[model samples]
Target: MHPSFTQRVTALEGLRARTRQATAEFYQKPGVMPPPLAPLIIVRSSGNNTFSLINRATGEVIAERFGHNNATSHARELEADIKRFNVKQFGRHLRDWALRISAILFLFAFFGSHA
Candidate 1:
């Protein structure tokens, strides 16, 4: 049998607490610094077929929308947010890939022309 919504939420909260404790301990070692914690989002469906976007770190309801369609849309929005955050975090390295590819193509073209 499927667990009820409250049970699932409780489990998730427990897991989050444990993870936070572990992270704190790991960073307490000498010469180690802790970075900002990432936002952990959870999507859950209720018995009534409604969906919620929850922030596991703060146990906040990011959003609560009804129906499967709205849930899917919200999921997509969350995905976009993650992508945006990744771009902001590692965008410079990603942009370097374009330059590297261009350099490789230029070398290929130049070498092929001489052949």
Candidate 2:
């Protein structure tokens, strides 16, 4: 029989992929205003209590929004920034976020030993 852990990992990946796809589709839909894509790295600074985004490819820092820790506000800011960023750059940033999130999930699944 297939290992139970293997099944769990697969399920996790599927969930992540679906979520990522939905987010992307939302930005790409017609008549939907897209955000700027200057920040390659979107960080929720625990200490600063602000949302920060960094564009590593261009070494540029776009606008930082406060009180955008929630999903709706974060998405709005991202959509705004996405318009300012190059299409190619936006693609790269999206891929980077996806990879980073996937790695985080992998670590939690593989290393978090249960009692």
Candidate 3:
């Protein structure tokens, strides 16, 4: 029999903790380096009629809805929420890029004048 979603997620969370510990140990070893950890996104859909958006890092339930009848409306709301989140994330990235570019330009203007 297939494991339930909650059970699978619980197992994965245990593995994630172990991986994090191993990563910490690897960093402590002499001259050992690994690539940065990538973000994790887990998506699941079931006919059981429940919806949830969770933040894996913080273990927070950002949003959730229950009931089969409201599924369509819930899905639409979730889609809009995702769109808003994406736009906010995009804005943050743009702001960060602008800051980096400004810093580089400032450095060039400051150092170039001295050279």
Q: Show how many residue pairs clash in every candidate, following the order shown.
A: 0, 14, 0
Candidate with the greatest TM-score versus the true structure:
1
lDDT of 2 by residue, 8-110 (tens): 9999999999999999899898899877545455554434556655455664555565665553366556666666779898899999999999999988988
| Model 3, span 1-115: residue lDDT tens | 4569889999999999999999889889989887855433223344467766555566665556566445446555655665575877989999999999999999999999999
Model 3 pairs in collision: none
Give Cα-based local distance difference scores for all models: 0.81, 0.70, 0.69
Candidate 1: what lDDT? 0.81
Task: TM-score each candidate.
Answer: 0.35, 0.31, 0.32
Looking at candidate 3, what is the lDDT of residue 75?
Answer: 51
What count of clashes does model 2 give? 14
In candidate 2, stretches whose alpha carbon ends up further than 4 angstroms from where it belongs are 40-55, 58-115
| Cα lDDT, model 1, residue 33 | 78
> Least lDDT summed over 10 consecutive residues: which range in candidate 2?
38-47
